[model samples]
Target: MRLAWKRWIFSLLAACTILSLHAEDEADLEQPDDVPWEEVKSTLPAYPEAGEWLPFFVTSATTNTFYIDAKSLEGTKDGVMHYTLKVVSENGAVNVTREGMRCSTREQKLYAIGDDRSKTWREPRNNQWVFFKKWAINRQLNVLYDDFFCPGRIIVYNVNDAIRALRSGVPVSGKSSRD
Candidate 1:
């Protein structure tokens, strides 16, 4: 009986150790490959607040710049954070307007550095703007350096994902189909 108990304890300890190591490996895989982790951390801008406008441009195409006015941050509820945003083009034209864009905390942490604030903005594509939201600025840096864009053109990464979700017909909080 004593020996059986000892074997059980040893097995439990070994399993726990293996699980811990696996988690550590998964975390390391999440880091971006193009930029050094430290550089990515140093380059991020401060988190935006209501009424602040942030100018962002894709590095590969410098002239294609846009602005996002931080309209509001409706606090997190049920593990998801809600945001309101206004995306404008360089010529002072409003491209896309979003109300209560939903971002889950899990997605926020994956691409963000520091406190992993959810970052969502619009990017231009095919002569129109598309919504793209990543967790952090570091993710943006990685995308700017590695992703493909047409000459003198800027586009968002996987805009279709947002479109697909929208087409699914799920309504955002505080808004209804009747509205």
Candidate 2:
């Protein structure tokens, strides 16, 4: 009898919890959708100057930084935002520049490391595992930043995981963070 009563109580509690969560989701959905662009910009940190690197996202392989030399913002009639960011990197003696997008959708365009003619990336030592790591990082960032109501200025890689990964070292080029 006690076990049956306890089970009934547990089921009731679970149902109540689920209903509460559903109510909260409905409340959020019903809220006004007019997010002021100025307010959003105000929430973000100050833009990094030409020479400074801003923390875009990080991975086990590289602490990816955005040297946004220039940025242009535009808003579509449907309210989608577009950002054209000019990124410059100086790895060794080679100076490479590419135009990347930080936009409202997953249609991101990432350029090759070298110039248009060369189309090659001379990756540094201890950094061959960057592209895959970066792809995953950007994928998650898209899910977060693409949301119009997402209240986040930046996405950060877990510090503990980063330290562990660094200590363990790279495990071949295409290996993911989970591996």
| Model 1 Cα lDDT, one tens digit per residue, 1-179 | 99779768876775565456422132432333454332111122334434444444333222244433333223332222233233444575443332222121112222221221344343223322123332122233223212211111212224332222233332222222123
lDDT of 2: 0.31
> lDDT per residue, candidate 2, 78-164, as tens digits?
322323232334353434433223332223333323332354343333411121112243433332232221222121223233223
Task: Please give the CA lDDT of all the candidate structures.
Answer: 0.31, 0.31
Q: In terms of TM-score, which candidate is strongest?
A: 2
- Clash numbers, per candidate: 0, 0
Error of 2 at 136 (Å): 3.0
- Models 1 onward score TM values of 0.26, 0.27
- Candidate 2 — which pairs collide? none
